[model samples]
Target chain A: MGFELETADHPERLRRVAIDPLSRVEGHGKVSILLDDDDRVRQVRLHIVEFRGFEKFIQGRPYWEVPVMVQRLCGICPVSHHLAASKAMDVIVGAGQLTETAEKLRRLMHYGQILQSHALHFFHLASPDLLFGFDSELSRRNIVGIAAAHPETAKRGILLRKFGQEVICATAGKRVHGTGSVPGGVNKSLTAAECDFLLADSARMIDWSLAAVQLIKQLHRQNPALYDNFANFRANSMSLVAHDGSLDLYHGQLRVRDADGKLLFDRVDYQAYGQLIAEGVKPWSYMKFPYLVGLGEERGWYRVGPLARVQNCDRIGTPLAEAERQEFLAYAGENGRSGPLHATLAYHWARMIEMLFAAETIAALLADPALQGDQLTTSGQRVAEGVGVIEAPRGTLIHHYRVDDDDLVSVANLIVSTTHNNQAMNSAVREVAKTYLDGRRLTEGLLNHIEVAIRAFDPCLSCATHALGQMPLEVLLYDAGGAIVGRLCRASGGGLSS
Target chain B: MSDVFLLDGEQVPFTVGQTVMAAARAAGRYIPHLCWHPEFQPHGSCRLCTVKADGHFAAACTLAARPGMTVDNRTAELDDQRRTLLQMLFVEGNHFCPSCEKSGACKLQATAYELKMMTPHFDHFFPDRAVDASHPDLLLDFNRCILCELCVRASRDADGKNVFAITGRGIKSHLIVNSPSGRLADTAMSLADRAASVCPVGVILAKGRGFVIPIGERRYDRQQIGAAEEQ
Candidate 1:
C-alpha cells in the first residue's frame, strides 16, 4: 500500500505516505507520496482503482448502438459520450456532415451539458472549499453549508444548474440517459415552445453566469498566494478550436500549446490523434498518462479541460463571453498574448467563463432560424472506421470505433478528458505535497489541500475509471522505516476522520 | 363471489385459478414481471415475479391464487432476490440500455429501475449473438434477447402464426424464427402482429423507426413500469 524513498543522509532508511479512496471528485482514487529521510518529497502517484471495460465489451455491439452504449461510461457527462459517440457513428455511416437542424440541436445539447456539468462542479463540489477555507469544519464545507451561509448564491447555482438540465431535457429528451442524438443525426428537434422556454430565462441565466465569473475573480484576488502557488506546475495545454480559431466545444479541429504559450500543433484532425498524442501506462495506476507524441514520457505530459481550453483558444465566439475572456486573460497576465496559464486554481475561473459562453451560445442558437428546420437526419454509405472528438465540460473527449463488414463494433477506444489530465493531476498533487507537507505532522487540512489541487482540475474518476459507487478518499503517511506515521480518511458522505 | 388473496396486506380479488401476477395486475398493483402477457397463457419464464405465498417461494405469473392466501410480493427479501435475478439476466446477455432503441420502454430495464438495481454486479457474458436485419420492416438484434418467451407465446397463442419459438437450452437457449429459411423476411411476421411488439427487451424493433417517440417522452421515462401499466 506504500512505497519507500531514500535520503542522502540516511542511505538505509526510507519513508512513505498514502492517500486512499480520494474523495469529492466523482469515483474512487488514492494518492501515494514517498518522502526521503530528510523530509523531501521524492515521488507522488495518483492511483485509480476501479475499471469498467467499455472498450472490450463494446466490441460486438452494432456500430449504430455505440453512441447510446458508450454513454454509460459516465453519468456526470453522458451527453459528452452521447455526442462524441454519435459523431463517430456519423463518420461510420458516411454522414460526416450533418443537416443544419441536426447540427444546431446537437450544439444546443452540448452547451447545455457543459453549463450544467460546470455548474455542478463549481456550485455543488468546489464552492465549499473556495467559499470556506480548505480547513473549515467538514460539516460546513458542502452545498448545504453554502446555502445556509450564502442562500442567494447557492440558489443561483441551483437554478442555473436547473436551467442547464432543462435545456438538456428540451433538446436531448432527458437529463440523465437521453437518446435524442442518433447515428447520422439527432432523432429529435426543439419545438418553438421549448426554444421559448429557454429564452424566457435566457437573460437571467447570462447575468448569473457572468456574476459567477466575478465571484471567482474575487476569491482569487482575496487569496493570491493560495490560489497561485497551490499546484503551479507548468505543462502543455490542448483543446478543440473552430476553423476561425474560436472556441468550439461540439465540433472543431485539434490544437495544442506548450507551457510557454507557443503553439505545438493547430487545426489537426482528431483522426490523426495517434500521430501526435500517445498514452503511457504505469504500474501504480489504472489510469494511463497521455502526452504529446514527440515530447517523450517525462516532458510530454499535458493538461486539458477548462484551464487548457481557456488558454489554448484564441477567442470566444459569443460576444459577451468574448469580452469576459479578454478581461480574464488580461487579469491572468501577459496582455494581448496567447499562452498556457500554469496556475491550477485558474480552472474555476475558466469554468465560469465557459459557463457564460455556453449560456450565450444557447441564446444565439435559439435565435437562429435554422434551428427550426424539419430535417433531422441524413443516411449515407457505411464506413468501417471513424473518429469523433469534442470538448466535454471536463476537457477534450475522443471516441474511435472500428466495425467489421457486418457493421458490428469490433473495436472501441475512448480517451476521456480526465485521462488526458491524469499525469498533470499527479504532478500537481506532488507539487502541492512537496510545498505544503514539510514532513512535519500532517493535518486534515494538509490532506485536503492535496485534494484541492486535484479538484482544481475537476477530474471525473467515474468517467475515467468506469467504476460504480462513491469515492471515499483516504491518505496515509509513512516514515523512513515504511511504517504509518499519520492517516486521514474522508468518507463519501462528507465526513473526515483521522 | 370472486376469490380474494391477501397480497402485502391488501385484499386482492381474483377469479379462481388465476395466477398471482394477473390478480395483482387486475387490482392495479404491480408485481414486477416479464414473459407473462395479459392476453397470453402464463409461461412461468423469467422468475422476476417470484412472490412468497404463505411460506413457500413461487413464480407469481404461474402461482394460482387461493382464497385468503397471504402473498408477500413487495418484501425486502423478495426485492433483493429480484435484483440479483435482474443482474443475472443483464450479464447473461448484452442488455446495453443506453444504446437500445427500446430502452425507456423496455420491460427488463423498467423492472430493474423499479427494483433499484444499480450495477450489473456480475461479469458480462458477451455472447456472440446474431443481428437479423433480413426482415424489411423489422430488426432482430439477438444480442439483447432476455429469453422471456413473450414473443414465443404471443406468436403462437395470439397471432396463431407460430413464427417465433425457443431453441437450445441453458445459456445457449434463445429465440428462433419458425420460417423454413429461419429468417424473419421469409416469415409472415408483420409489424401489426402482436408478436412484433411482444418482446420485453430490444431484441425485436421496427426498422427505420428508432427513437421516433424521442427519449424523455418514452413509455417508462417519467413513470416506472408499475405506474405506466396503470395508465
Candidate 2:
C-alpha cells in the first residue's frame, strides 16, 4: 500500500514519493524524481527514511570506543569505516601520527579490502550475466552458477578474496571487524613469520590476478555485443589523494579534471571541498546532488569510481601495477582525453588494474619494519575540526567532523564517493533510458540497464546511506498542481555503518 | 639485577620481569607457542613453548629471566619435546588440521612446523564435539579445542569478562560458556571483545565470515610469526 509519483506541480512539484523494497540491491533505498507539466525533472527528492540516530546516540560516550562502535556499519567494508572513523578521531583527540611502517600497514589493509570487495563484485555478483547468458533466470544467476560453470575460476576468485581478507584480519585483529587499528598506530604488530606468510601468499595472488585479468578479457571477447562494448557516457572526473598531482588512493591531494584533458583543479586542499562543491537535497531519494560550488544545482556532470580515478591519476604507483595501467591507457582514448571510458565495461578493466596495484602496494607495506610502532594512540585529547579521506572500493569517501575539547563529535558531515557521482549517475540512468528503455514498460532489459548504470559507479548504499539500524524507505508523490498522487513505504532491518 | 645469557654466539643482558619467551622474541629468536598468546596469562597447555632453562624443559612464556640462568631456545632436546607435545595435542582432540580454517593462523601449526613435526605419528582421537553456530557472528566447535585455555584467559583477563570456563577433569576437560544457555552464540559478543578473536584453534570460529581468504594465500601460509623475536 504505497503511492508512486507519476506527475507533480511547478515550483513546489513534489508533495510525496514512494520507493518500495528496491529489488536486487544489497540493501533497501528509495528515489523519486519530480517532474513538471512537460515531464521535465523539476526537483529531486531524497530522504533517509530510517533513522539509526547514531549522531544522537553517540553523545557522552567515551571517545576512544567509536571505532569498534562504528564497525557495525557494513560488514563488507569494515576497514573503510574503521579507518575513516579513526582518522576523524585522530583529528578530535589529536592522535595517529604513525610510523612509516604503521602507514604502510594501514594502506595494506585498504588495498586488501579493495581487492576483496572488487573480487567479490566481479566473480560473484557481476560475472553471472557474462558467464551465463544475460537472460538467465534470477534464481540461476548467482555464485552457484559461477561455481558450476567455472569452478576453477570461481575458486581462484574466492581464494584471492579470502586471502585479501585474511591479510587484514591477521594484521588488524578480525577478518570482518578488526580492532587492531587504533587512534595513533596499530595495536597489533606483525611478527617476522606473519610478514613472511603475507608476502608469499600475496606474491601468489599477483599471479592469480593476472590470470583472472585474462579471463575477464576472454569473457569480454566472447560477449562483445552484450558485455564488451559498454554504454558510453562522458563527464568531469574527481578523485582523492593524488601523488604529485596524479591519482594516489591512500594519501594524495584531490584532483578534478574535465573530459577534454584539461586540468580543472589538482591537489586541491581537502578543507575546500564545500567551497569547491555544493550539494542539493531532493525530496525523492536520500542521495544528495553535488554541483560545482558556484554553478548552483546540477550544472556540471562529474564522475567517480574506477574510470574516474584512472583518468584523474597520471599513472598507477607500483612498478608491477604500472603494466596494468599501461594496458588501460593503451585502449582508452589518448593520455589526454576521457573519451568512451565512462561505460560499465571500463569499470571491470579499471577494477582489475586497481586490484593488482592494491596487492603489490600492500605487500610492500607489510614488509616495512618501522610499522611496528610502540604506540597506536596518543596522549592529547584536543578536539579540532578535520577531514579524513580515503578511496573506498566504490570511490573517494570523506568524513569531516567537528568536535569540542572534550573529544565529543559536534558536527559530522560525510561526502560519500557514490553521492559525488549522483548527477553523473542520473545522466547515465537517463542515457540507459535513451539507449535501452525506448519508453517501453520497465522490461527486464531496461532494469538491467538501470542496474548497469548504477554498477558503473559500484555504489555501496551502505556507505552512501550512513544511517544506522532498522531503516525503512518512505516514498510520496504529488501532481503538477501539488495534488496527492501516490506513496509507498516499508520498514526494513537496518545495519550499522562501520 | 644484571644477568647474561649466551644466545647463538654472544652474551646479552637478561633483564628482570622479562619472560624467557619474551626475551627470545626481543633477541630475535623463534620460540613456538600456542598457550602463550602475548596478551594472556601463561597456562602451558600445549607445552610446545618448552625451552631449556637451567638445563631443563620449561615453558618459555611463563619462565622468568633470572640472574645467571642460561636458556637454550634452539636445541635437539627442545625440538623433541615440542614434537612430543604436538603429538599429544594431535591425539587428544579432533584436530583435523587439513579441514580447519585456522590451519594457517593456528599456533599449533606454527609450532609443529618449527619442530619439524608434521605427521601426528599417533592414533586420532576423533572426538564428536558439538558445534554451535548460534551467535549472530561467531562459531564454537568444541571438538577442535585443545584445552589451551587461551580463549578462557582472553575472555576473563583481556576482555574483562569471563565468558568461558573449563568443565570436567582429565580427558573430559572441555570449555563451556558461563551463560545458562551453555552456548557461545547466546553471549553478548561484539567484535571488539578480545574473546571474539583470541582463539588459538579452530574450536572458536567467527560464523558467516570464513572462506573470504583463500588457501595458498592465507596470512600464515609462508612465514613463522615468532621469528620476529630474532630481529
* Top-scoring candidate (DockQ): 1
User: Is model 1 an incorrect, acceptable, medium or high docking prediction?
Assistant: acceptable
Ten contiguous residues with the weakest lDDT in model 2 chain A: A1-10
Encode model 2's per-residue lDDT on A1-498: one tens digit a residue: 001122234457433233433333334544445444444444332233433455453443334445555656566777876677667666665563655555667777788888897787777666776667554554455667679888997898899899889887876766876665566545556667787888888888888777766777566556656553455666777787465655567766778777665777777877667777777776555667776775456445477777788767887778766777676666565446445365566677777778877877777777777556543444365556767777878777776777544444566676766678766766665555445544343323334555555555566665423232223544455775667655444345322121
**Interface RMSD, every prediction, one decimal place:** 2.8, 13.7
lDDT tens string, model 1, A335-432?
45445568889999999999999999988898887777889998789888889999999899999999876566888888999999998887788778
Candidate 2: segments with Cα more than 4 A from true spot: A1-24, A30-52, A95-97, A218-231, A334-340, A371-383, A464-498, B1-231
DockQ of 1: 0.35
Each model's DockQ?
Answer: 0.35, 0.02
**Residue B176 in candidate 2, Cα distance off native in Å:** 36
**Could you give candidate 1's per-residue lDDT for residues B21-132 as a string of tens digits?**
9889988999988777888888788888899999899999999999999999889999999999999999988776656778889988998989999999999999877787
Chain A TM-score of each candidate structure, as shown: 0.94, 0.82
